[model samples]
Target: MNLEEKLKQLPNDAGVYQYFDKDGHLLYIGKAKVLKNRVKSYFKFTPKLLPADKLSPRIYKMITEVESLEWIVVPNEHDALILENSLIKQLKPKYNILLRDDKTYPYIYINLNEDFPRLEITRKVLKEKNIKYFGPYSIGARDMLDSIYEIVPLVQKKSCIKGKEACLFHQINKCHAPCEGKITKEDYAKLVDEALGFIYNKNKLVTKLNSKMEEYSADFRFEEAMKLRDRIKSIKKSQIQTGMDLATNENLDLFAIKAINNKAVLVRMFFRDGKLASSNHNYIKQNKDDINIDINEAYSRAIVNYYDNELPLLPSEILIADEIEEKRDIEEFIKQKFSKSISILNPKRGKKKEIIQVAHNNCDELLRLQNTSSETSLYEDLKLLFNLEKTPNRFECFDNSHMMGQATVGAMVTWEEKFVKSDFRHYNLEAKDEYAQMRETLMRRVESFEKNPAPDMWVIDGGETLLKLARDIRDSCGVNLDIVAIAKEKLDFKAHRAKGSAKDIIFYERAGEILKLELLPSDKRLQFIQRLRDEAHRFAITFHKKQKRKEDTQISLLQIKGIGEAKVKKLLLYFGTFDNIKNANLKELKEILNEKDAMLLLNYFKNLEG
Candidate 1:
């Protein structure tokens, strides 16, 4: 059907509508209570189809390009909201504001199932029933865990208990020798409770650290004092000091969005027991010409996309900076999904308004800082240099690391304003040659495009051959992705690996021709590409070293007369590292394996040393 006829057939029931251009590319998606009114409001008949007079410049431009319309009728607005989010994520329409921040924050957790559990940090939700999780901290989780270990006498390491004997940690008094039954389980529980108090009360933890710092300084332990001082600063920095406590012990999640020049920043703050616990911010880059986009839609998508995850805790209420048009729909969706009654409020006055103002100010400051950063100019330079279709917001770089074709591995690192560590991936490749390894890595990545969509560009760490290989792999997968490769200057067909003195060349395909450009070492664009290539190299090498180490350990231990895979694994688990196992006496080995097997292992190690 034609666009006009399809518009006329729109149903009155709630549903999602999609706009497409002449080339059949999705332009936008929207959910509405009445598909007919909402879809018709974008255009006026007036004898001929035209954009409505009250439409924003952004939407007006979109309407001018929209050549077709489609709608899916749903049972109600709640389903419409859900379907809209799902389609936008899967399709990634042009006009939609996609939140690129998929990072999982760290949480300090304790598995209570163990008799003497050690505190550890995790980015994912564990499947343990008897567990307690602390904050989903944006920063300072490691520092906090370290400080707890420094202050309390708990199990110092995971392998400590399995050792079934005291180690250096117990001798140094960092642990209570729980492995040797020097400390009772009840006493260890007290230490665990003390550590929990530090996680629960940030202020108390800071105060205690300060006292310890003072004590250390007075005893001439300046180094120890300085370390404690740094930890205290880190823990304090994690807490958002809003300066305006609700004083009512109310819990809420505050969301504030600010946009300017097609750049939007969403600031989210979590308040628990009337105190600001943690906060996070995300940057949303809109279409190039979409400066005056709708803020209400941005707010709606942000709230829905964030809460879509299985959160560890849900606040009693949600506060937003603006009164979005789809507030009621979001609340209903949340109620249905979470089975919890919560209010989403946009306050006009009082403490709630003040809190929202704080978040808004944060968003504004973040946007301002982003505008002034060198990354903006760097992106513009890169786009012009490469003659790219648009400023590349997201980049995925690939590199291969191996030792004479042994322990081959490939790594892909992501960059969006910063190194997106969560999206970085490493692959163990069986392909021995460099070209084959690069091809395999790119192929595997392209195959998973449905789950993890392709980035705007691919940066490879090789010369023209590997670059073309990447392009061929991507094309074979029927995906149109930009690719560039950086390689070190070659001397007599050998790559110069020296840093600072070696020059680098960048190659990109333009108009079906391979173009090689050699920029000065001082060029910011060159430095940017170098950073990405180096990170990919570092990641791949790290993984390769780990694989190589594991292989070496397996081969060496399996050669021992009474040791097999199971016994080797037990020894490694107890000692944590191969070096530790080598230094371990017969007693430590016996703790993990049979006495005879332990003797055999000890003799093998001793003979090697001799």
Candidate 2:
């Protein structure tokens, strides 16, 4: 629709709005409390009250080029704030501030789906069902893990169920030997809960440690008492300090922002027990037209995103360096998600204000250093653009090839940053159906995980049907690998005719929800995936042809003079039935096959296509 028509129909509620250029390229994305009022303000202003010169030159250019407008209405401003962030990342509009980070901290994760769960260290935390993740402790993540292991007596090896005998760890009391039935699952579960409680609540941890120290003294074990005493003191001293005057028992998250030369930097200082526990900073690349945007809008957008998608952790209080546009909206969202009360404040005085300044100062140094590395940034872009958990450094592309349900074969090509020919493999299939071929192929490929584990991701050369098979294989094998599917826009299978060119359909996922992306031919990601898929196709087709060549000898018709295996097979197929060819007279067969071939084929009971 035209701009005027779209504007007249704009909703009067909070929502995210988009401005598109004549070419249908997204120019800008924004969140507004009242979509109608906010959108109208852009073009409705007269030169007298609101001077045209007051607007940023970049905005003026964007406004005139805007041929169409679209909006998605949400329940409240917080929903608009969230929708806007997701769209900005997905579309990467020309006129918006892009805030992202290349580095992610390590977190201790527990996968509760296993019969005996395993605790592992991971830098990436995904929102999957039945999995718990803790800590982004920057400097001492290893030490934190070690501390928990010592207190919990959990499994220290890859598989506790495998080591039937009490290993060294169990002998030294580092593990409770669940495999040997020395500890019940119920008892072991309590120890795991206690370790998790210590990580989440410090007061309870200190109290429990203190009680242990007293018990050791009453038992007359002075050496153990001294050790327990030192542990208690160390726990108390490990408390973080933020140089703030507020009470040290409450938890808070302090946010600060700074913008310069149209680029912006945001800093978030996490406070637990009213002390700085961890901090994060990200620089935002702003579009030229973004000069007209206010810092308050940025803060509002940042607040919604940081709490909702970026971190799983939460605090009772959230302090901002400046007032944001929709404080009530943000508070409401936080309350609903956490199911508890939350206070969002803009401090005017006291220590809360001082911490804001400290965060702001950190942004200045960040801008000076410009420490964003290029290699890491590329992977971040790939992850966001492709919707992946890890940077796909190694990926495999799979494809199946067949000719008339004969000589069916499946091929998988490995790519480590680029093609790795030595790691490529082909599977001979027994299934005649195409979809069945895919399932069997994937089952065999994943079975190899016993000897060689799966790649970072698998790129299948088909649609969601093939992707589902890949996912099933991964779950059954207990392998952790991401799946991507690439298919053609059209499927044409005319023999001896060139396959028409079509755009690739890329299937990606975010938090297990699959999304389809169609990029232009010139897009780099599309080209890269095409190369991987094409290699797999080439490998499969080449093997299928080789299989057909080998089978040609079994017919024994290829040894005949002036007659080939291909011509003989085609003549047999043209007939309604292959058995008719064996009984046909020379005169009857010459009409379909050549005279010399008719003599040769009449002598041989041709066994092939009907």
Candidate 3:
């Protein structure tokens, strides 16, 4: 059915709607309480479908491109909100502001289940009981953990207790020697308590370290003193300084968003016990065609994406710089997901507002620094250099690595202001030759364009032939993406790999003709492309080595009588590693495979050992 005809059949219930262009590419996804009213608001009937006059520039552009409409009817607005967010993240519509930050901050945790628990750092929450976690520290988590061990006379290593004898740590007075019964359980508990005190109070820890450093200096132990001094510096530097404390010991999380032109920044400050513990910030940039910025939508997306995890570290109260339209919906989401009630507040005045102002100030300063930085100008120079229609704010670089057709792999790394490690991808290619491997990789990527739309440009790590190959692939897919390739300088008709002397050449199409350009080594544009190519090369090589190792493991397992590639794969998946498989008992092997195959594998291991 036509878009207009479909619009007439819209339901009145709450749901999410998606708009697609004539080319069958999604333009936007949105949720509304009344699907019919919200879907119709973007258009003016006038006997024909046309964009509404009062729409923002961004929405008007989206409406003009939208040729089809799709919707999912839900029971209520809450369901609609959740479904919309999920679809937006999965589909990544062209006109939506996606929160691409998938970083997990570090946390210092201790599992009290052990007799002598040792502090450790982890990025993910463990599914174990009697575990105490502290400070989702963005930095200095490792240094802080080390400082705790250095100061407190706790067990230094997990293996120390298993040895059943005094180790070097005990000799040096760093550990209380709980393994040999040198320290009682109560005495060890006191030491653990001292470590916990340091984790709770940063100032006390630094003061104690300072005192230790002075004592070491007075005893002519300069190296130990210097190490302690560095640790103290790191801990202090990692701390987020918010001079004004709320004075009420209330744990809260503050969010502030600020936008200038098409760029925005989201600053999050985490406070524990009414003091700032750590802060994180993410920069959000709109697509080149998108001019209108929606602060409310940005705020909603940031909050939703941050808390969209299995076990998020939620705060008692969330303070925001500005009131969002979906405040109640978010609050309800948190309560339902975590089964804990929390407040989402926009403080007009007082301590809450002041703390939020600190977040706002951070956002403003980050935006200002980013705006004035050379990175923004570099993209402009790139656009002019390549004769592109729009700035190449986001692009992907491709490289392939192999060893004589063995363990061949291709990698694509994304660069958007920085290397987006989360978006980077690796492909194990079956093709033996370089050209075929490149073709297979590019074809796979092009097939995924429906979900992840094409970037502004593609940087290929090859000469003219491979550059043309990338262009042909994009053209066959009907994707309007620019393509460029960088090739190292050739010496004696062979590509040179020397670092300093080689002058790489760049190839691109300008007007139906391939053009080669060799800029000076000092040019930033050339350096930028080189950096992208280098990152792609590094990623591909790393994947190739990993594939080689896995194949080596598979080769050893494939020697078993009943173990083929599929069975080996299944065994590896269940056991995790070859060492684990070697140590698995007959019962454990039977759980993954049949009794016959499990017995064969067990006998093979026994025979090998014999």
Candidate 4:
């Protein structure tokens, strides 16, 4: 299939398309909500030819063995990105620049369970657990690490080799040497409050620090007072001002829009509990309609769509990308949605504008970062592609399994961020055939979810047919969820046989047994489906096989007449055999089985056992 032939079949609507190589490997994955519009832009209409870059050679290779085309039609461009990443990982195409690390960032934690919670760094944070973590902070920043170190001594924590004999730090009068028992455990624990107060509540810490300094000076402890003063000065100098000093009731999110080259970038700054929490930047490749729309209209559409899906944890205040003409209406809308008065700001000057400027600067930095390098953040791209309210942190995949028509089962595998949580479930599929198996699998899945639903997306392991099947089950069970199927890619390049039967072709009658899903001479969809389906099948088969084997062994021994449960169990355990009674002579049977039962067993074996 050449470009002309492929172009003729491509759709005009906005969606995503993928390219595969001859080995049936995905080579390039991309999204263009407008199918024809995006594809046409790739080819030059001018008489003069253009030079190709790094992506050019890769795409050229992908087109070479292009035997088939596949596409997914979604609501918009953002949804396209979400779909793109889902496919990219599902297919792991050879050419797309993939993000490698999926590790969670380490955080600084204080265990609340201890009388004196120790200050240590950790990676995980849980609300149910009795501990508090300060950050998912960067491990590489030297200054940040130094700041954490500095707080240790100022909080009066002992540094004297467990605070034993006077160390250099104690000699320098900077350490309290609590480890040497110079300070009592209770006093040291009190110091923990100061350290936590500093890291978690910097403003309050500064105020408390100044008060402590003044009190020390008044008591004629000039040396101690001076040390306190110096520490306060250092903290002030190191702190980077993230705009705003709002009250505790106000948590704000500010969004700013910047567009260039037919793409729009949105910058978001988050303020939680009256302080800057975190920030993010997103880029959206625009269609012609978006390009023609003014900034305000685009902003309105984007914000409304964003909130509709995400309902971002609305704070008391918000900052807008552009002033919506329906500000009153938006306020009323938010009030109805959140039951709180939300103040939307378009800061023209002062600290508010400064905060907005800071957000804009970060956006520009991110844009430069992307332009200069091929690397892209998966979180940003996924959010843009899926039009997801937020980046998917948790996802669950479902697949059904059966052997022809027996021992059917379903399985749910979960991926939090990127790591699999294998303990979730291996369901026993109770329904028959492909459709019923899927239905039963999803019904059980939704039932679990009805009690506790906690996934951003539920991925199915079949194509369009199974995708719809999963949804229908969810509907019947009154469970609402977003789902998609990762089907086998059709193979159109394999050679024809003597009878003209193509070796690579795969067919589906919408909903039928997945007997040959990927078990054919060569089917692209087969590879994709088998990975997920086989896993589900393996889990199901393991469960059923264990049960079958247990039952079979038990029934085999039960056939012995007059043996009774006790004698039959003993003979099996003593001989470690299932056919021991049938083979044993009368004397050997008498020793293992009961004396009277042994004769009956011998008679039964002689009479009927084979």
> By the lDDT metric, which is better: model 3 or model 4?
3
Question: Rank by TM-score, descending?
Answer: 1, 3, 2, 4
lDDT of 2 by residue, 207-239 (tens): 766776678788998897787666665555443
Q: How many backbone clashes does candidate 3 have?
A: 0
- The lDDT, on a scale of 0 to 1, for candidate 2 is 0.70
Instruction: Give TM-scores for every candidate, taking all chains together and pairing residue i with residue i.
Output: 0.82, 0.49, 0.78, 0.38
- Pitting candidate 1 against candidate 4, the one with the higher lDDT is 1
lDDT of 3 by residue, 1-610 (tens): 9999999999999999999888776778999999999999999989778999998888898899999999999999888988887777655677777665634677788889988889988777698888987777767788888989988888898778888789999889999888899989888888889898887778898999999999999999999999998898889867657787788777787889988777888888888777777777878767656676888898898887766654436689988899888899988887877889889999998888888877888888898898788888898898889887556677899999999778999999999888878679999899998899999999988876644556778999999999889988876654556789999978898998787788899999897678999999899999999999999999999999999987765577886667888998898899999889988889999898999999988888788779
Q: What is the clash count for each candidate, in the order shown?
A: 0, 0, 0, 21
* Angstrom error at residue 103, model 2: 11
Candidate number with greatest TM-score: 1
lDDT of 2 at 322: 84
lDDT of 3: 0.84
> What tens digits encode model 1's per-residue C-alpha lDDT throughout 182-244?
989998899999998888678888888899899999999999999999898888878667887
For model 3 the TM-score comes to 0.78
* Candidate 4 residue lDDT tens string, 1-610: 6545676788877788866544444455667758887665544434532222332443544454555456778877656655664454334344443222223434456666754455765554444457765533322222233444444563234233443365666666656665565766678677777676656655665677688778889999999788777767655543235646655645676777775554456666656556664454455433222222235534543444334322324566778756776555456545655577877778788666778787777667666765564222443444444344334334577766555555566767765433354335776666787777777777776665412343545667656667667656654543223454655454463333345453322223222232232245444334433444445455656776765554555574576555567766788777776565466777887677567877776666566534
Q: How far out, in Å, is residue 305 in model 3? A: 0.3
